[model samples]
Target: MKFALSLLVGAAAAQCGKRSPSYLTWTADSFIEHGVEKNFHYTQATLYLGYEAAYELTGDEKYAEWYRNQIDDAVVLEDGTIKDWDYEFYSLDDYRIGNNFLWWYERTGEEKYRKAADIIREQINRHPRNQAGGFWHRRPVYPNQMWLDGIFMADTFYAKWTKMFDNDNTTAWDDILKQFVLIDSHTRNHTTGLLAHGYDESKTAVWADPVTVNRDSGSAPLVWDRAVGWYFIALLEAIQLFPESHEGHSILVGFYKDLAAALKKAQHKSGGWWLIMSEPYPGMEGNYIESSASAMFTYGWLKGIKLGLISKGEYYKAAKKGYKLLTNRFVRADDECLLNWEGTVEVGSLCCNGTYEYYISIPLQTNDYKGVGPFMLASYEWETY
Candidate 1:
C-alpha cells in the first residue's frame, strides 16, 4: 500500500514538474547511508524532524523506523531516563530532540518515551530566564542572552508538549507567546523588519549595548539569515499547536505574517539569502548566498503556505525559486552517491560581537549537519507542497 502511494505521489510530483529523481529520498538515503552522529544535539534533532516530514509525505515506514531506533540508541536509555542527560547545564539546544520523544509516545503508547519527555519538560520549566522573561539561550556560558536559534530549539518542543500534555494550562500558553513577544521586542530591526541574532538582557556581553538594547547600539550588529530562519519556523510551529480559541493564537499568527513579509523582501536574486541579511554596510562587501538559512526559510515559507497563514499567490513563486536554487547551487552529489550540502556558515553565535565580519568570517562546511538537516526538510516540504 505504501509502495502504491509512493508511485502515485511520484507521478503527481512529476506532473507538477518536480524533479524526477526524488531529491528528498536521495538526500535522506544519503544521510542514512553515511551514518549520523549519536548525540543529543539540535542538529541531529533537525535531521530527525526532516525524517518525520519525509515519513509523513511518503508514508514510508523506513523513515519512522530509522528515527525510532536512532532515538532509542542515542537518546533514551532502557530505564527511560535520557542518556547522559544533564540537569545542571540547562541548554535549550538539548531540549529539541525531546520532540522525538513525544513522537514515539504518540505512536506506540510508550511510557519510556513519555518519561524522557517529562524530564525535558521539567528542565524547561526550571530553565533560567532573563529579566524580561526570555529563556536564556543557555545558562552560565551565554548568561542572560536569548539567541533566535534558541526559539526553534526549545519553544517548538514546548508548544508540542503543551498541546499533548497540558492543553488547558493558560499559563503555559501565555508563557509560550510571551517568549516570542519578548525576543521580538528586544531584537527586531526596524529598517529590515527582521530580528537580530540575539540579545543580552543584562547588557554585559561584548556585543550588547550598555544603555539601549537595540541593534544600532551593537546589541546585535547585524541580522543573521539563519537566526531569522529559526525564528520564522518557530513561529509557524507555535501557531500550528496553538488552538484557534486561545487568545495568543491570533497574536502569534500576526507575528508570523509580519516576519514572512520581511523575509520575502530579504530574499536574494539567487533565490537564497546572504550570511549578512541586512542592509549594505562598510564591511559587507563579500556577503554571499548561504544554504542552511535558505533551506530553512524555504521550509518556513512552504509550510506557512501549507498552513494557509499566507496566500500562495504572493509567496509560492518565491518558495519555488528558493527550492530550485537550493538544489542547483548547494545540493551536490559525489561519486559515491552521497549528498553534500555546501555554503553553510560553520557557526554563528552571540559569543562574539555579532558583526558583519564575524558572521561572514565563519568557516564554511560541507554536509554540516545544520545545512543537511534543513536542506532535507526543505526538499520534503517542496515535494509535498
Candidate 2:
C-alpha cells in the first residue's frame, strides 16, 4: 500500500507538450509503475477514473488490467464484501471506488464485483439524509450538511448503479435529480453562477452564513475550485446515464450550462482557476492558480462539448487554453521521463468559516492523486476529442 513519495525514474517520452496521446500513455504508465495501493480512498479512486478513461481512449488492456488487479487485490474480500471501508461511517467519499466495482462487473459479469457493488448500494439506501433529502456529507462529522463534492462521489455511482441494476426504479432517478436541485437552489449565486463548496442545511455549521455571503445564500463561505470541479464532472457523468426523456434531465442540463458559463468567465488569464474562486481578497498573498480544478474544468468542458451539452467554439477555446496551461504550468517531466503533476491544493473544507485565509493556507502537493487523476482525464479528453 506504499506509494513512492519521490518521483520515480523511468524511460519514456520526455515532453509535457500540447495535445499528444503519448502524454496520456506516459502519465498512466507512470502511475501504474508507482504501484496502485491497496487502501480504499478517494485519491486512488479518482485516479482509477483516469485509468478507466485511458482504457477507453486507447483500448490498452494494461490500463484496464491495472485497475482490475487493484480491485482484486485491494478492494474485494473473499466473501464478496469490500475491505478498508467501514460500514459505520456513512461518508460519500467511500462510495466513489464502487464505480470501479460497477465497471468491473460490466466487464466480466462476475458475481463478485456485483456483490461488492451491492454493498455500496445497500449503504446508499440506508445513509442518513437531511430534511430536504440531500445526503449529509458524512455522519457525525459534517452532519446535516451536503457538499458540492459529495454529489460527485455518491450520486454518480448512484445513477450508474440504478441504470445497471435497477433501471425500472423510477424513484431512484427522481432522487438523483433532487440532490442536484437542492444543492443548486441552496448554494448557487444567481449573479456569479458558482456554487459554494458545501451547504449546511440546518444552518449549524460554523461556515454557513445566516445571510447571503458574496451573493451565495447560506452555503459554505467560498467557492473552493475543486469542490465546484467535482460537481461539474459529476453532472456530465450522471447526465449521460440519465434517461433523456425524464423531466430531471433538463433540470440537470440547466444547472450544468449555468455553471459552465460561470467557469468560462472565471478562467484566470493564465488558463487556470484561483484556489479561492470567489471575489479575490485584496492583499491575499497565498492565492494561486490551482491544478486539479483546472484539469477538472478542462475535462468537463471537453466532455461536455463532446456530449452536445455545450457548444464547441467558446468552451473548446477554454478547454484548450486550460489544457495547455495545465501541461506547461503544473504537469512536468522528470529526468526519467515519468510525468509529475503539481500544484494541487491538498484539501479545502467547510471548517474555519471556509475563510479566504483557510482556503489559501492549505498546502500544495505534487503527484497528489486528486490532481493526477484529473490531469490524466484532461489529457485524454484533450487528445481524443
Candidate 3:
C-alpha cells in the first residue's frame, strides 16, 4: 500500500510541471498591482490560500513570495499591528484571511503574523451564536442565521488556533464540533441528502419556510452549490488539522464521508455540479454547471481521497472527470499565456425571500476570484494526486 501511494505521489509531482507558472504569476501580479484596496478583501484572501498550496506543490519560491507579500500588504503595519481588520462587525467572512496569517506565521516565525491572527481569534471569541450554539453568519442584521459559508470562514481557523496555541483546551474542539452538528441538523434535506444554503433559527427570514415540518423547514429555499462547496472543503480542512486521537476527529471524518457520498450522487452528467446542485437535470431553466463550486467539490474529493478519509476508485473517477471538465469547459488561455476561468456566478446570497430566478439571474463572470481561487486549489490537488 505504501509503495502504491508513493508511486501515485511521484506521478502527480511529475504532472505538476505541466501547469503554467506564467498563468499563476500573471494572476497574482494582476491582483497585487491593483493595490491593496482590491486585494485586502476576503475573496482575494481565498486566492492567496491557493497560491500558498501551489508554492508547496511546485517547489516554487515565487508562489510562496506572492502569498507572503499579499498577506503582508493586507495586515502588516508600521507599528507592528495588523491594520484594516474589523473585529467589531463580528462577521465570519472577516476571519477567512486569517488563515493566511496563520500560515505565514508558521512559515517565517514572524510575530506580526501571530499578532494579526490574534485579532481574528479575538473576534471569534466574541461572535454571536444562535440558541443551538451555531455561530451566526454575521451580527445585528443577520441575527440567528447560519450560512453554510461561515463554517469555512471561521471553524478551520478556530480549529488550527486551538491546535497551535491551546493544545490543552478541549472545549474549543467541542465548540467547533457543535457548529457542524447544529448546521447539519438544521440545514439537511433528508430526501436529497444535501444541505441548504442557510438556516434561520428564528424562522423569520422570508426565504425560510416557517410552517413546514419537513427536514428543510426553516432553511433557505434552495440547495445552493457554492455554499455547500464551502462546507465540504471546510470539513476536509478541519480533519487535516484535528489531532487523530481527539474525539472529534472521527466525527469530522464521518461528516465528510456523508457529504462526499451525497455530492457524488448529485454530480451532473457533464462532470460538473449545477448552480443549484439539486437541479442537475436538463431543461431546468436557469440551471447551469457553475465553475467555482465544481472546482471546490473537486478539490474536496481529491484532498479527501489523498488523506485516506475517502475510498478510492469512484471518488477518484469523479474528481478526474470534474477536473477535465473544468479544463475543457471553463479554462481558456490568453495570448500571453495567462489562464482565464469562466462560468462563475459573480455572487449569490439569500436576501429575504429570494427565488430560484434570483439565483439563476445573477451575473456570470470570467476570472472572478471565487472561481479562480478554487480552480487553482483544485489544479494543485489534481497535480498532487
Most accurate candidate by lDDT? 2
lDDT of 3 by residue, 236-298 (tens): 889988888887889888888888999998988777888886544323865788889999999
Q: Which stretches of candidate 3 lie over 4 Å from their true place?
A: 1-39, 78-80, 210-217, 279-283
RMSD of 1: 6.2
Weakest 10 consecutive residues of candidate 1 by summed lDDT: 1-10
> TM-score, each model?
0.91, 0.93, 0.89
Instruction: Give the runs in model 1 whose Cα sits over 4 Å from its true position.
Output: 1-19, 210-218, 281-283
Predicted structure 1: lDDT? 0.81
Which candidate should be chosen as best, given TM-score against the real structure?
2
lDDT of 1 by residue, 1-385 (tens): 1001111322333444444767788778778888887877888888887787778778899988888878885688877899888888889989988887898899899899999999999999899998778899887799888888998999989999999989999999889888888888778866668887887777778878643346443356578888888898889889989988997899889888988998899888878787887777413466777788999999889988988999999999999999987877776666565666677878888887767777777778777888887887788878877
Clashing residue pairs in candidate 3, if any? Answer: none
Ranking by TM-score: 2, 1, 3
Model 2: pairs clashing at backbone N, Cα or C within 3 Å: none
Q: What order do you get sorting by lDDT, best first?
A: 2, 1, 3
- In the range 1-385, model 2's lDDT, one tens digit per residue, is 0111222211223343323336677789988776767666888889988888889888999888778878885788767888866888899988988888888889998888899889999999999999889998998888889999899899999999999988878899999999999888888888899888888888887888856643434588688899999999999988888998898888888899999999998998878887778875422567778889999998999989998989998788888888877766776667656677778889888756788877777888888999999888888888888
Instruction: Tell me how far the alpha carbon of residue 201 in candidate 1 is from the true structure, in angstroms, after superposition.
Output: 1.2
Give the backbone clash total of model 1: 0
Instruction: Please give the RMSD to the true structure for each candidate, in Å.
Output: 6.2, 4.1, 6.7
Off by over 4 Å in 2: 1-21, 213-217
